[model samples]
Target: MEYQAAPARLSTLDANFEHDFAQRLHWSADTDAAIEQRVADILADVQKRGDAAVLEYTARFDGLQVDGMTALELTQAELKAAFDSLGDEQRDALTAAAQRVRTYHEAQKRASGESWSYRDADGTLLGQKVTPLDRVGIYVPGGKAAYPSSVLMNAIPAHVAGVQEIIMVVPTPRGEKNALVLAAAYVAGVTRGFTIGGAQAVAALAYGTATIPKVDKITGPGNAYVASAKKRVFGTVGIDMIAGPSEILVLADGSTPPDWVAMDLFSQAEHDELAQSILLCPDADYIAAVQREIDRLLPEMPRRAIIAKSLSDRGALILTRDMQEACAISNRIAPEHLEVSSSNPHQWEPLLRHAGAIFLGAYTSESLGDYCAGPNHVLPTSGTARFSSPLGVYDFQKRSSLIEVSEQGAQSLGRIASVLAHGEGLQGHARAAEMRLK
Candidate 1:
C-alpha cells in the first residue's frame, strides 16, 4: 500500500551546464595474477578429481561442508515436484514469463540451410549448415539473493535453440535450492542442477568430471570472481559475456515524474553497491528533483545502505544543452539498459546506436524487461555492448559450413586451391588438392 516518497517539487531550478559527467565511466579488472592463478589451480583440481574437487571447493569457498557428491545434486523427481509447491499466483506468473521468453526466442530461431548441389565448370556445392550446441551450462547466482527469473531467462532460450542438455549451477549457502528457482527451472524444463558454485563450478562445467559432464558453453551472471573466471575460461569453452555490474541510463527531458525517474534509477542501484544509475537530462531542475527523490526513497527501500552507496559513488546527472548532446552521451556510454524518457521515444530510438537493451518511454521501465519482457537481461555491460549483444538463442547454437565436392567439382576447385597453397609455399597442401584432380 505504501511506496518510497517522491521528490518534493522545487520552487527554483538551476539551469547551469555540467558536461563533466562524462568522466564517471570506469571499470577496472578486479582480479590480479595471483587470484587468477589460484582459480586456475582450483580448476585443475576439479578437472582431475571431478566430484571430490567440487565438494572440496564448496566447503572452502561457500563454507558449506559437504561429504559426498550426490548431496549437492538435485533429482529429476524433486525438480518435478517443485512446481506443485508454488502458489497459484506464482505458478501462473512463472508460466506466463516462460511463454513470453519462449515466443521471443522462437522468433529469433534461424533455420538451417538445406543440402544443395550445382555444377560449376567442374561442378561444386558449398554452403553453411547451422547446428545447435549439444549442451550448455547456466550459472545462477545465489547466497545474497535468489533470482527465479534468471532460471527462466537462461534456460528457455537454450531449450528453444535446441540445445540437447542444460546443466544448471546455483550457489546455495544452505545447500538447498530456492523453491521459486526450482519452480522456474521446472517450467523452463532444466533437468540437472548442482549446488556447488564460485570458480570451481565454472571449472566443472568447462572440463567434465566423473559426476558433472563438461558443457560446450556457459551463460549467466555473478560477482567479480565469476566474471574473472568467465574471462579466463574463454576459448576452452564458450561464454555469454563477461558482464560488469548492472547499469541504467535514463534520458529524460523532465516530462516524467521525479518519482518515476528515481525508481528507475533505484532498480539498478539496488542490485549492488557497484551498480550504476545515471540521469541525462536537459533540465537541471529535473536533476535536482531526482536527487531529492533518491534521498527520500533510500530510507524506505529494503536495501537502503546498498542503494545509498551505489547512488553516491556511481550515480550522476549530466546536464546537457539539448537532446542532441544527451543522445551522443548515451551512445558513448553504451549503457546496458537505456531508457529514453525524452519528448519522443520513437524519434530518439533511431538516434541511439548502442545498448544491450533499449527501453523506450517512461512506461517501459527496465524492471519490466527484467521480468516478463521477452528480451534477455543477461546483457553486455561495461561498454561491451559496443561489440557484443544480449544473450539469445544464437548464443547456444553453432554454425557450420556445408561442402560437397564431386570428382568434377574437386578437379575444378583443386586448381584454385592449389594456386593459393603454392603461393603460400605449402607444398603438402598443394599436392593434397592436386591428387584429387589427378
Candidate 2:
C-alpha cells in the first residue's frame, strides 16, 4: 500500500503555540480495557494452574501446541548450537556488543553496586549492603521480531550485578525459533530458556510454575499485552517499568545536513506507528529543508508504512525562537532519546536535562546508542524520563540498610528513639528503646 507522511508544522511565535504544542505532544500510554481484562484473566489462570495455564496460552496465542512444559524448555546445548549456527558476521557482532555492554556495566557496578559501611564518632556502624537479586527474568520479544540486542542489554547488566540466575523467555510462534535470540541467551549466560511468552510467560515468571522458577524481578520490553501484564504483576514481583512507545527529540542548530536529520527521524518512526519523532529548530529554512529530505528519503525505507504512519500522526517539525527555547521545550517533553545535532552540542548540553539518553553531536546517531554504545537501549518512554531512569545494573540489584549501634552510641540514640515513639503513642516501642539504653 502507498503511504504519505506529513509531520505537523508549528512555530513558537504563533498565538496558540502552547495549545498546539500540547496537542502534538500528547500520547496516552493507557491500554484498552478489554486487553487489560484479558491480561488479568490470564494472570489469574496462570497463578492458579501454573504450567498447565502457560502451555494452554502458548498453544492459543503462539500456535505452539504442547502437551507438557518440557516441550517448551530449551536446553543450554540447544542455545549453544544456535550460537554456532550463526554466520560469522552475526556471531562477531553479537560478541562485540555483549562485551561492550558487559564492560560498561562493570564500571557501573564498581561506581554504585558495591557495599559501603562507615563508623560514626560514637562507634555506631551505619551502612548499605548491595546485593543482586537471586534470580531475574529477561523477556525478549520473539516470533515476528527477534531483538538479540535486547538480550544483550538486559542480561549483561543482571549478570554484572551478580544475579545468580538469569532466566530468558521468548515466544516461538508457530514453533519457529530465532537462532540469534537463542545464541544471545547462550552468550549472555542465561541460566534457562523457555519458548513461551505473552502475559502467560510474565505470570509464570512472577508466580512460578512447575517448570519455570519464580524470579525476583522481570526486565525488558514487549507488546501492549506484555506491558499490561508487567503493570499487574509489579507488586507480586519487581518490574523494570511499564514502557511506552519509543521517542526521539532532535534539537538541531542547522549545522547538520537536512537529509541526515530526516533519516534520524525515520530511525525512531520505523519502530512502530505510535513512536514519536520531533524536530526542534530555530531556522525555518532548515526545517523546510529537513521536511523536503524526509519526503525524498522516506520511500526508500523498508518499513515505510510504519514510518509514514508514525511520522504523520505523532511527529512534528517545531520552530523555536532560538536554541535556548528548543532546549526548554525538550526538557518539557522529557523524551526517551534526545539528539543535539548542532555544531556546539556541549553548549546546550547543560540545559537539556530529562532525557533517558543524550546523543551529542551531528555524527552520533541515536541508533548507535541502541546497539553498541555501551549504554542501555531499554529507556524510559512517553515522557517517563522526567521521573524514571534507564535500565541499568542498579535495577537488577537492591540495597539493605546496615545498622549496628555500639553500647556507647545506644544511650544517645535510645533517648531520641524513645522520645519519638512516646510522642507517637506507642508505649511498647518507647520501652523497647529504653530497655536497650541501660
Candidate 3:
C-alpha cells in the first residue's frame, strides 16, 4: 500500500485557505459600508412599515409573490394537521431520527454541574445551576436548500432540554414550505411555525413583530445576508455562530479505496463553490490515485460544476511525512468535518482535539452525520471549530444562576458581601443584602 510521502512543500495550496474556502477568504471580510447602510435602511423601513416592509423585501430578494396573510403565521391546527398528514413511511423515518437525536443529546445534558458546601471558619454553601432557555428561533434555509435535517437538528435538543417555546422559522418561497421541512418540525415538537425567512426573518425574530414574537436566541445556517443579519442582531438576541461554507478534511492511507474518498469529498464540495475538500496522505502514489478518482467522479455528479470549482480552488492533496504529520495538519485546519479513512481510525481518534464532527472508517461518511446519524449538521466552519461547538440544545437554552441562600447562609454571608460592595462604591448593593439579613 504505497501513499504520498511528505510535502516537498505545500506548493499546491496557499496559507490563506484558513480564512475561507476561497484564497481571498471573503467569509471573514468586513461587511461593506454600503451593505451596512442598506441593511440599516431595510431595518428602519421594516420597523416603521411592519409586515408591509418585510413583504416588499421578501419579494425583491426572494422573488416570491408571498401573500400578506400567508407570510404571517401558521395556526396550531395547521401544524398538527401537517403532522397527521405525513405518509406512514415518512412519519416513521422522522420518528426514528428524532429518537436517535434525542438519545445522543440527552446523554450530553449536564445536571447543574457540581454543588459544594464549604466550611471556612463558618459553614456556607455555593454551587452552580444549569437551566434551559424559554424560547429559541431556528432559521431553516429554504428555496434550493430546504433541509429537513436542519429542522430536526435545530429543534430536537431544545425539546430534550426543556425549552418552552421552540419558534421554528423557515422562509417559504411564496408561502410554500417543503413537506420534508414541515415533517421534521412536526417530529421535533415545535409549537409554532412562522413562514418568514432570510434577513427579514432574522430581524423579526430578534426584535419581534405584531405577528411574530421575539426569540431569546437563533440557530441554523443561511446565506451571507442572513449571516450578517445574525451578526448585527447578536446583542439583541443570542446566536449560535456565524457559519461559513462547509468543509471536510480526510486523512486517508492506501488501505482505503480512492473512490470512497472521492465520494466523501463530493458530499461537502457539493454544498457550494466555497465549500472545502482536502486530503492528507503520506504516500505520493495514493494522492495521485485519489486525485484521479475525483476527476472521474466529478463529471458524473449532478452538481459537478460546484464540486470541480471547490476541488480546483480550495482543495489540496497535502503531502505529509507520516500519519502524525497528517494529524498535526488537521489540528491546524480544525475543519468542520474530519474523516479518518486510515486503516486504523482509532489511532488518530485521540489526536482529534478539535473538529465540529468526526467520521471514522470509510463507511462512516460525512453525509450520514449531515442527516440521520443523530448528531447536528449545523457546525462551526471557517476554522471556528478551534473554539466554537456544533449547534445543540444548549444553543437554544439560556441558563441562570439559582441563588437561594438560607437565612442562616445570608446572615453568615452578609458582612463580606456588604464590605465588598462598599469597597466597590456600591453601598446600595451592600444595603440590599445586609438589610435582608437584618
Using lDDT as the measure, the top candidate is 2
Each candidate's TM vs. the true structure?
Answer: 0.90, 0.99, 0.86
How far does residue 233 in candidate 3 sit from its true spot (Å)? 0.9
Over 4 Å off, model 2 = none
Pairs that collide in candidate 2 are none
lDDT of 1 by residue, 1-438 (tens): 333423222111233322234335676746777778887788788878888888888988777787787888877777778889889998899899889998888888744222334445555666656678899999999898999899988999899888889999999886757888888888897869988788899989999888888999999988766777778788989999887789999989899999899989999988988888888888888888888877677778988777777877777777777887788878988999999996679988888999999998879999999999987888999988889998888898787766778898787779999999999999999999999986
The better-scoring model by TM-score among 1 and 2 is: 2
> Best to worst by lDDT, what's the order?
2, 1, 3
What tens-digit string does per-residue lDDT give for candidate 2 at 1-438?
678889999999999989988998898888999999999999999999999899889999999998799999999999999999999999999999889989999999999899999999999999999999999999999867889999999999999999999999999999999999999999989999999989999999999988999999999999989999999999989999999889999999999999999999999999999999999999999999999999899888999999999999999999999999999999999999999999999999999989999999999999999989899999998888999998999999999999999998989999999999999999999999999887
The whole-model C-alpha lDDT of candidate 2 against the native structure comes to 0.94
For candidate 3, the clash count comes to 10
Which of 1 and 3 is ahead in lDDT?
1
Off by over 4 Å in 1: 1-19, 32-34, 111-123, 406-412, 434-438
Q: Which ten residues in a row are the worst by lDDT in model 1?
A: 5-14
